[model samples]
Target: MAAGTPRVFISHLSGVAVFDPNGDQVGRVRDVVVMLRTGSRPPRVLGLVVEVVSRRRIFVPMTRVTSLESGQVITTGVVNLRRFEQRAAETLVLGELLDRRVRLIDIPGEEQGQAPGQGDGEEVTVLDVSMVQLPARRDWEIDKVFVRRGRQGRGGPLRRRGETLTVDWSAVMGFSVVEHEQGAESLLATFEQLRPADLANVLHHLSAKRRAEVAAALDDDRLADVLEELPEDDQVEIFGKLAEERAADVLEAMDPDDAADLLSELPESDKERLLALMQPHDAEPLRRLLSYEERTAGGLMTTDPIVLRPDATVADALARVRKEDLSPALAAQVYVCRPPEETPTGKYLGLVHFQRLLRDPPFTLVGSIVDTDLRPLPPDTPLPAVTSYLATYNMVAAPVVDESGALLGAVTVDDVLDHLLPDDWRESAHREPAQVPVPVPVPVPVPVRGEGANGH
Candidate 1:
């Protein structure tokens, strides 16, 4: 073990023969068990099992190793054959040694939300697996077959057992162990797997550019979910990287309230750009929501709700609901309102749960089916008070109305959570104060190295 010589582990010594100091061949070196010294412990080798007499087994202290050569090993002395006679069949077991070779896979450019199969339309490759062993954190079991020039070769393992190797598992395009000779470079080639929520958490930890790369790698639905979970600041930052049309598509896929909250944080110019790119129908609800104060009930409600005239048949209401693609938040309940009058004003009559509507006859008047005992909140009510009301009544959402009882919007449970606690609250709290630290003018030091014109 010279100071500059690289320390290496000898795996797969099965074909190497063993000899004693006298130059007589005793048997073969079946396996060499090395104890790994980790932390503050001194290094010690244990369980050195050797095959002898061509069919017998013997256990000897690693101190017996005289020298390891290219094709064989030399020992100080030979052991009694009878002592290993009973252990011949089990001498090759490397449970303690082999267990150290297990390694985890690491894939680059592939994040938690990206589809696992492909990356950016290109195939990914599974790189070499790393291995680690116990007690010796400094040493690794690297006896993997290294394929080079379309031929098989041997090399020391770079990773420890249970350690992960990031890889592109998309397709088996081609491979070369030389390509992964550098551990850091290899790890950088594979992507990491993470859940949607975890991905959002990671985005918050990354720079704006890195966040955008991850967002782009994800599918529309996954990116939308992550967008909903991200802080308003991060959402705006990441959204800036996407094309206006792509950004609008992601927003349209998001819950209207969540989309509104994100859009409200953008510059007015950027907001309008995104809105202009959105489908008119999808953009309409978000635009309307952006008009309201972020903390207000109207701002927190989804406008794409199911509404029916009190005089309309229950069947007709059901028909309208079935015909339209309503968001889950809006589809939870049906609001029964007065039929449109000449002035185009309608009154909020009552509410009907989707389940109840399905159980009643289609011809039944919506007013007859609407529960008169409606839990309604005024538009101007504070969000906290509205949350308390919902909890007290155990309601999924409460209808919001004007003084004249006109149906305005519905405040949902998700919106309530958003109103109560936004994602950036902590970051905002920990952020540096708005007032910049003023610079105190200091006396300037004159240069002494260079003298005046004559070089004095």
Candidate 2:
């Protein structure tokens, strides 16, 4: 190992594609794990949280990693597919360390070689960390930390105070590899930095009590986003922990389809109770969706989409698509109806593809060029039928209509794929321990439940 052998910053590692010996993409790197060393040794790289094709995260021991370069990580072919569980002693850099405000510890009257904050205890934010393969060491260890003072948020344009001050890992505090304890507020702050999907994955790996605590710590909107990405059982479990009103608010914040799916898993008593707590307008669509069998098109459709009336202009339609945060499949086209442009919209007339919108003048009516040729499916249409309808027309989404010809909702390809996957897909484990190369247990990181820094 050499100092110039190309060190990779931990911040740049997130979402980086990781490949196996055969060059097959396994998954993206979600987080890096390391163990704190005693004496003056730097923390050693232990493993990586790699999310695979099924969206299940697993641990890839550093011993199995061959190379980290060119924006991609290469593995030595030995992968332990067992879903990763954060050991008591392991510290997660990205998930727990990034964006933490810490006080730098320094010796008094040692200004010449003192750390930036000195003994004055100024707060600094850990932006990113660096890992290097030190000479004569088999493992890469945590080295220099990239940080900014007077700013405690995720990375943005590089900023500095008086001058860039380099601090060794020993200069910072709050990381304890012995009793990894964290205040509730510290964990909450760290959780806020993770993506919703990543947070959901992390919650899944946590103890039930820990999950409830973390869930309770999130705001409703954020909780709703994370809940949507979680499995039904986990969703229900977390919901059970929330107050009735809070749970309803979270449900209302969720996409109607996902909310309905979660509700459908609940008993009728619990379902009605929660529905009653939600706003009538928001609950109505979910009620209708729940009535449809889980395998039906109606059940898979999302209530929200870029909708337009026949009289609306292409510009109006385009503007709607632009303003709304819709998935690509849902935004591919705008549905044209008679009057109402909301869920359970007016009698379905047709749709305007994005290309057609671009071709027509902004003021041109969407109805004039609408593709009525694309027939909409009924609420009771089977999942197989919905799949065929989308495939036949090469459309990413298809409208679901009722007997009265009113647009109920629109089903996207993503929802359809969810149904097509094996029912136990979420429950399946993609990782299994390897017999030929067993991972030896080592010392763990005593973190403060998450990333946090305060000069000791």
User: TM-scores for all candidates?
Assistant: 0.49, 0.68
The lDDT, on a scale of 0 to 1, for candidate 1 is 0.55
Candidate 2 per-residue C-alpha lDDT over 89-181 given as tens digits, one digit per residue, 9 for 90 to 100: 677887566655655665234445645544445556677778887666446788876656664223233335623355677666645522232
Q: How far off is model 1, as Cα RMSD?
A: 22.4
Model 1 ranges off by over 4 Å: 1-195, 205-208, 308-332, 338-347, 354-367, 402-406, 422-456
RMSD in Å for model 2? 8.5
Runs with alpha carbons beyond 4 Å of true place in candidate 2: 3-13, 16-28, 36-43, 47-91, 95-135, 139-222, 427-456
Each prediction's Cα RMSD?
A: 22.4, 8.5
> Residue 113 of candidate 1: its Cα lDDT?
58
The alpha-carbon deviation from the true structure for residue 116 of candidate 2, after best TM-score superposition, in angstroms, is: 19
> Can you write out model 1's per-residue Cα lDDT over 49-127, one digit (the tens) per residue?
5544433345544444555556666765534333222121121223222211211222244334545443232222223
In terms of lDDT, the poorest run of 10 residues in model 2 is 447-456
Pairs that clash in candidate 2: 81-431, 82-431, 89-444, 89-445, 90-445, 96-451, 176-446, 177-446
